[model samples]
Each structure stands twice: as structure tokens, then as C-alpha cells.
Target chain A: MTADLFLQILVSGLLIGLIYALVAVGLTLIFGVMDIVNFAHGEFLMLGMYASFWGFALFGIDPILSMPVTAALLFGVGVLVYQVIIRRIINAPMLSQIFATFGLMILFRGLAQFFWKPDHRLVTHTLVGGNVTLGSIQFGLPQLTAAVGAVGVTAGLWYFLHRTRLGTALEATAIDREAATLMGINGQSMFALAWGIGAACAGIGGALIATFFPIFPEVGSNFILIAFVVVVLGGFGSIVGAFWAGIIVGVIEVVGGFVVGPEYKTAIVLSLLLLVLLVRPKGLMGKA
Target chain B: MTTIHLPKTVGALALLGFALLLPLVIQDPARQNFLILILMGAQLGVAWNIIGGYAGQVSLGHAVFYGIGAYTSTMLSLKLGLSPWLGMLAGGVVASAFSVAMGWPCFRLKGHYFAMATIAVAEIVQVLVTNSETLEGAVGLSLPMGNTGVAAMVFSTSKLPYYYIILGLLVVTVLASWAIERSHIGYYFRAIKDEPEAARALGVSLTRYKLVAIAVSSFFTAMGGSFYAQKEMFIDPGSVLATGVSIKIALIAILGGVGTLLGPVLGAGILITIEEYSRVLFGSTGSGTDMIIYALMIILVAVYSPAGVMGLLHELRRRIPSLRAKAEVRA
Candidate 1:
């Protein structure tokens, strides 16, 4: 392969990596603070795609313009889901929490199919066109936009989580929910906020992904597995870890898919995950 | 335990006799197929319950093991002229060893992480099956049925043989489950299920017992796959080892009662019946009937009774002890 083709693949990979970071960041946050691995996190991304799809078709809006509204809408839904369904089982049992999210995933996916049909919903006409050709490498406009958007959103959230009071409160709740309560902080609210914000990140990621990729009923499932691998590989609860891991994962997926047929790539990624997990169970960015 | 109280061995024999005679009584091909499917499901549920129900592993990937058994048995018998009856046993062994191979690395993570790991494992297996040149690469392998005596298990022409075969499997599975329930290993499994760290501290080896559960559970599960392959007379990776397949098997265990013996079987019977009815109604091919039935079962069981259908029955029987007493006297 020519150097230009190599540059093109790498650029595409880095662009996709940014999107992976956006999606995984929320999972990292929820895991970091709440220690709850919401198995239905992927379904939220599915809903976000549906939201963006409707936002464009019904309202005649651009994806970038509809991004915040899409994020906020899912944000509220996340808080509601947590308050109504999650709160009841927060202390019930591990299986209950696991199954509850699973059930909700089924429920949400069912709803999506019921309402939207199982067809690929996309914003084809309004797609950002034009390619940037630099040093014999072609970088598309959509790729550039998604990459920039992902990085900007990630940085903004990083600043918010690390610098803001609410961020510290979220971190405190994650550290110890009961202790945070004893310290006169509303741990419940923080959890709700964390899930809400995390969901927003998923929504934005979904919207961004839908720009270049097709959206099907089980599309989120495709990303969900890879995201899980990324999360596990990067570290269970580190945003920075998720960031780097996402990029590394994006590169590996593309490179591995190219080198060893698409079928073997999943095995490679999962085997990598298992290896990392066995060697370092605490995760890449996770504290031992 | 029933109206005619006999020796345990005799009672078991009588039940087997009844099952063997089912094809004779139910001459209708459809009913025979349903019965065979139920028996197959019952066997599978028992297999899944050993690890998922008894050990509380909640693997959403047992179908891969099942697929391994089915494919191995079919391939060896067709290619090497091995007896499928023997091939099935070998298939079971292969699956059990594979389970142990996977269990070593995966048993470290708990709950969702473990579940995802299993999912990944199954997906990788599916990919392997799909990509392998030997396996025919997605188009799948075709094996001739009923060639030389008992060499090939290709007797899907009549539902009677399948009924007997699955019935035999169901009996073996029940016996295995009963043995596990009464064994010391069963207690260690329960300990691991309810309290892992405490069990670990109290001299119980988590990995050892967990692997045992997985191996035993997978052995039967793989056998169920073989039985299914024999009955269907066609073996393919997609039919046996898909994500939906694992999810369905897990649902069967969850539906009946994960920990209790016979719960998953009961659940599987009901679930299979529902699925058959749905197929009859909706004519297969992603008909929403299965989803509707599954959703209802999940919701009702999850909300009203988290312990599942058998657990609900136990609770109801407890609440109305007079009904239990009357039943005992009637028996």
C-alpha cells in the first residue's frame, strides 16, 4: 500500500477513535463514580440515533445543530431511567441490577423496532461533503468534523469533571455513596447527574457515528461490544484511560481488520482484552 | 412421590417407559415433534442450570459449547466414519474442556463483566466457525443422515427416534442434576453463588469449583446440542451457537428457576411450547410472537416473582399449605 493510503486509513482511524472516546467516556464516568456497570449503556446510544434521525427528518435540521438537543433529551431520559428503574434496584442484588438493565435494553430495542422499523435510519442528503487532500492523503469533511467534535466534547467534559464542584461531588459519590450522603451531599442527585451526563455523551456519540455509519436496530450492539473491550482495556474507570484506549482500539480494529480478515479482528481484540485483564485485572488506568 | 408410590428406580423406569411410548400414543407428527423439542429443551435447561443455575455463573455463552458439540459430532461422524453415538460423547468432552479453557481466564470478572466476556468468547467462536475453510465458511456443512446402522444420527425422518433419544437425554440430565444437588460439590457451588469471598476465605477454591460446575454443565449442554443436531439432521454454526441461542438458553434457566432442579426444564418446556405456538401463529422468520412471549415472561417473572416460575409455585404452595396437604393425601 502507498504511504497516502496508509495516511488515509490512519486518519480515518483517528477520527473514529474520537467517537469511541465520546461513547466510552460516559461508561467510564458511571463506572468510576457509581461502580455500576449499566449493561444497557449501549441502548442509550441506540435511542440517540433514533432521536437524531427524527430531529433531522421531522424538523429539517442539521446533525451538528441537533446534537445538543439530542444529548439533553437523552440526558433527561437517563435521569428518569435511573430514578424510576435503577433506584429501586440500587441495593437489591447484583443480578437484579444486571437483569434490570438487560430487560430495559430489550424494552428499548423493542420500542425502537416497533416504532422506527429495523431499517437503517440515516441523514444522507445533509451529509458534510468535501475532502481535504494533503500530501497525497484524502481526509473527508465528515471525518474531520466528527474528530474535531469528539475531541472538543471530550475536552469540555474532562474540564467539567475535573475542575467543577459538581464534578468533585460526582467523584465523591463514586468513592462512597453513603459517606457522600453523610457529608451532606445528595449522592442520589449526583448519581442521577452522572448517568444523565454519561447518557448525553452516548447520545452525542451516536449522532456523530450516524454521520458516516448506518443505523440499524441492533447497531448499538455492534459498538457496545467494542466499547466494552475499550473500557476494559483502557481501565475500568479512567477518562484519560478511555481516551487513549479508544484511539488505540480504533487503530487496532482497522489495522487488524485489514491484516487478519474482519472475522479474526474480534478474536484479536477480545484476546487482547483477556490478556490485559489477566495480567492487570485492575485495568490500564484503574487503581489497584 | 406421586399417586402410585414405587421404588425410586422403578418410578424412574416407569417415567422412561411412558416417554418411550409417547410416539405411539401421540401418532400426530406435530405433537411428536413438540414432545421431542420439549425433551431436548429440558435436557438443555438441565445442562445450563448446572453452572448458570447451580453455580450462579449466568453465562450468556453456553450456546458456543453446544455448537462445539454439535459441529464436532457431526463433522467427525460424517468425515471419519465414526459412530455419532460415540461422536456425541467426544463432542461433549471437547466442549467441557473448552469450557474449562475459557473459565480459567473469565472466572476472574464478576456479573456484567463476566457476562460480556462470555459474549465476546461466543462471538469469537462464531467468527472462527464462520471463517474456517473446513467448516464451509458461513454457507455451512451438509452431512448425510442414517447411512450405516448407528454410524450416522440422521434419523430425522421419523420423530419417534428423536423423541426416544431426547427422552433418554432428559432422564440422564435429571439424574445428573439430582446427583449434583445432593452432592458436596453442590453445597460448595451454592456457597460460591451466594457468598463468594466468604466461600473463598473458608477454604473453598473458587476457580476449582467454578470450573467443575462449568465443565459438568457444559458437558450436558453440549450433549443437548448433539441431540438437537441429531434430531434436526442438519448442523450449522448459526443454528446452534448464535448470541440469540445463548440468550434463549439462559432465559430458559432464568424463566424456570436458576438454582432449583427441574426449574429450567419446566421453563424450557413452557418456553418451547410458546415458541412453537408463535411459529405456528406467525410462520417463523423473525415473527414478533417469540419476542412478545419472551417479553411477557421476563416482565411477569421479573416483577411478580424474581425467583422465576418454579420459585413462584413454591411461594404459592407455601402460602396455601392446605392445597399441598390435600395433594399429598390425594397422592
Candidate 2:
């Protein structure tokens, strides 16, 4: 590949990796807080994309303009899911937790299909409508904006967790539920907040990507496997790890696809996951 | 533990006998097909239970073995002109070998991690199959039309032979599970499941027993896949190797009663019935309704009774004194 081509692929990989980071952060946070994997997380991303698509199609609102609304909608959904389904299985066995979330995933996907129909929809016209070129490399404006949005959201989340009292409480609960309870943190509320934030992150990621990618009920499945790889390779329950891992996975997927074959990209990413799991189960940034 | 419960044993035998004779009595091809599906579900569930239920591995990528079975037998029949009967055995062996390779690395992880690893492995298998030209890639393979004989394991339209074939497979799987439950190997499996560290301390080789369980589980699962291929007269990666198929196998076992001898059989019967009826009721327009119902059932079962339908029955029998005596009398 030419240097320009390599740079192009690298930049594209980096942009997509940011979105993957956003999705993985939500998953990691949920897993960290409750020890539940939240298999329905990808469906939440799917919902976000659909939300953005509807906002654009129905109201002529650009996805970039309606990102917050989509995020809020997904936030409510996340909390509702936690309240209705996850709360019941909070203390159940590992298997029950896995299946409960897996079931919810199926339910959400089914509902999405039932309500929206199965056709793939896209928001063709967006605020970021054109491509930008610099030094013989061209890239979509929508992708750059989405990457910026991802970084901004990640920074905001980091600030909330580190600089805010409520966020600290949430982290406390995640670290040690019983100890946090003794320290007067409301475990239930913290759990809800984690779900809300997690869902919101995924929603924002989805909405941003909706500007460029096709929106469909099963779109989440395509990204979810990569997100899982990111989470595991980064370290389960570690947000920072997931962020970095997401970028790494994206780079590998895009670069590997170009080098190998696009058809085997998923296999390449999954193989990396296996290799990471074998060599370092805790991930790069995860605590031992 | 080796001592069988007389009542349950007799009831199970009676059920088996009834199932064996079901095709003869039904006459309707549709009803017979449903029975075939039920038997298939039961066999898949039982196979999964060996590792997921007994050993507590909870693999979510079992469709890898199922796909391996289907692909192996189909390819053998299509390429080498081998009979599916022998192909079935070859498929089982191949699946078993693959399981060992998978289990060796994956068995080190506990609970959810192991499950995730299995999913990854299965995805890799799927991706490989989808990209390979030798396997016909995504277009898949169809059995030749001319061979509709017992020797080839392909039938034109009878459905009776297929029913008996799957039923026999189910019987073998259940009996194997039952025997394992009564044997020392079963004890080792339960030991590893309940307390791995303690089991290891007590001289039980965790890796060996876990490998053995998965091997047996994958072998039977592959056999079911081969049966599925021949019965359908077609094989595709999407049909045989999907993650959804893996979940269904585990779902049947969990819904019926994990680790119990007859739980998967019962679970299969209930689930297959719901699946078929929902498909019929919804038609093409009702794409997601059946899935919705199935998902709801899974959530309910997981939340309310982790032990499954058999567990609920056991609970009921325990609570009602008269029922307990009746159950004991039957035993």
C-alpha cells in the first residue's frame, strides 16, 4: 500500500475505533458496577441508531443535532431495562444473568424488527455532509465529527466519574458494593445511574455512526462482537482499558481487512480476542 | 447414586416407547415433522447438558460442533460419495477433536469468560466457513437428488425413517447421560462444577474431566447436526452454525432442567411445540412474534426457576405431601 493509502486506513481505523470505545465503555461500566455482562447492550446501540434515523426522517433533524435526544431516550431505556429485568436477576447465578440479558437482547431485536420492519434505513443528508481532504488524503466529514463526539463524550464521562460526587459514589459501588452501602451510597440508585450512563454512551455512539452507516435492527450484531473483544482485551469492567482496546481493535480490523480479506475481518478480531484472553485475561488496563 | 428411581425409570421407558411409535400413529407428514424437530431438540439439549449442565462450562458456541457435523457429513456425501451413516461417525470424531482443541485453552476460564471464548471460537468457525470456497462459502451445499435410500440416509418424502433416526439418537443420548449421572465420571464432573479447587485438591484432574465432558457433548451434538443435514437434504452455515442455534441448544437444556436426566427432553418438547405453533400462527408477517414469546419464556424461566420445569415439579412434589408419596410409590 502507498503511504497515503496506509495513512488513510489508519485514520479511518482510528475514527471507527473511537466509536467502538464509546460502545465498550458502556458495557465495561455496566459489568463493573453489577458484574452483569449486559448482553442487551448492543441492542441499545441499535436503538440509538434507529432513534437518530427516525429523528432525521420524521422531523428533518440532523443526527448530529439530535445526538443528545437519542442519548436521553436510550438512557431512559437503559434505566427501564435495569428496573424491570436486570434488578430481578441481580443476585441470581451467573447462568441466569447471562440468559436474562441474552433474552432481553432477543426481545429488543424482535421488537425493533416488529415495529420498524427489517429494511435497512440510512440518513443520507446530514449537517456534516461533505468530505474533507488534506495532504492527498480524503475523509468523510461525518466520520470526523463522530470521532470528535466520541472523544468529547468519553472526556465528559471521565470528568463525571472523577470530578463529581455522584460519579464517585457510582465508582465506589462498582468497586465494593457492600462497602459503598456502608458508606451511605444508595446501591440501587447507583446501579440505575450506571445503566443510564452506559446506555447513553452507546446511544451517542450509535447516533453518531447513524450519520454514515446503515441503520437496521440487527446492525448491533455487527459491532457487538468487536465491542466484546475490545472489552475483554482492554479488561472487563475497565472503561479506560475498553477505550484503548476499542481503538486497537478498530485499527487491527481495518488494517487486517486491507491486508487479509474483508470477509475475514471479524475472524481476525475474534482471533485477537482469543489470543488476548489466553495471554492476559484481565486486559491491558484492568486491575489485577 | 447408581440406583435408579423405579418410577421415573418406568415412566421414561414408557415415554420412549410412545415416542418410537409416534410416527406410525400420526400419519400426517406435518405432525411427523414436528415430532422430528422435537426429537432433534431433545437430542441437542441432552448433548449440551453433558458439558454445560453437568460440568458447568456453559458454552455458547456449541453450534460450532453442530456445524462441523453438518458440514463434514454433507461434504463427505457430496465429494467422496460416502454414506451419511459413516459420515455421521466421521463428523462426530471431527467435532470431538475440535472440542479438545477449543476446551484446552478455554477450560482455563471460569463461567462467563469460558462462555465468551466459546462464542468467539464459534464466530471464527463461522467466518472461516463463510469465506471458504471449498465449502461453497455462503451459498451452502445441497444433497444430490437421485439418492433417496436408507443407505444414503436420504429419503424422498416418508419422514418416518427420519423420525425413528432422530428418536433413536435421542434415546442413545439420554441413556448415555443417565449412565454418566450414575457413574464415577459423573461424580467427577459434578465435583469440578461445584468446587473446582476442592476437586483439584482431591486429585480430580479438572482439565481431563472437563475435556471428556465437552468431547462427549460435542460428539453427540455433531451427530445431531449430521442427522439434521440428511433430514433437511440441505446444509448451510446460517442454518446449522448460527449463534442462535447455539443458544437454542443451551436454552432447551436450561428450560427443561439443567443437569437432570429428562429435563432436556421435556424442555425440547415444550419449546419445539411453541416454536412450530408460533411459526404457523404468525406466518411471514409474524416474523418476530415467535422470537418474542421464546425470549419472554427464557427470561421467565431464568428469573423464576433456574432449575427449569423439572425443578418446578420437584419443588411442587416436595411441598405437597400426597404428591410426594405418589411419586415415591411410583419409584
Which candidate leads the pack in lDDT?
2
- Residue B159: error of model 1 in Å? 1.1
**Model 1: clashing residue pairs?**
A33-A174
Query: Worst lDDT window (10 residues) for model 2 chain A?
Result: A146-155
To one decimal, what is the Cα RMSD in angstroms of model 2 from the true structure?
A: 2.6
In model 1, the runs with Cα more than 4 Å from the true position are: A1-3, B1-25, B145-151, B279-289, B299-304, B322-331
Q: Report the error of model 1 at residue B308, Å.
A: 1.5
Give each model's whole-structure lDDT: 0.79, 0.91
lDDT of 1 by residue, A139-233 (tens): 77877787787788778888987799888777778777888889889977898898899899899887776676777767877777777777887
Model 2 chain B scores worst on lDDT over the 10 consecutive residues at: B282-291
Q: What is the clash count for each candidate, in the order shown?
A: 1, 1
Q: Which stretches of candidate 2 lie over 4 Å from their true place?
A: B2-4, B322-331
Docking class of 1: acceptable
**Model 2, residue pairs in steric clash:** B7-B331
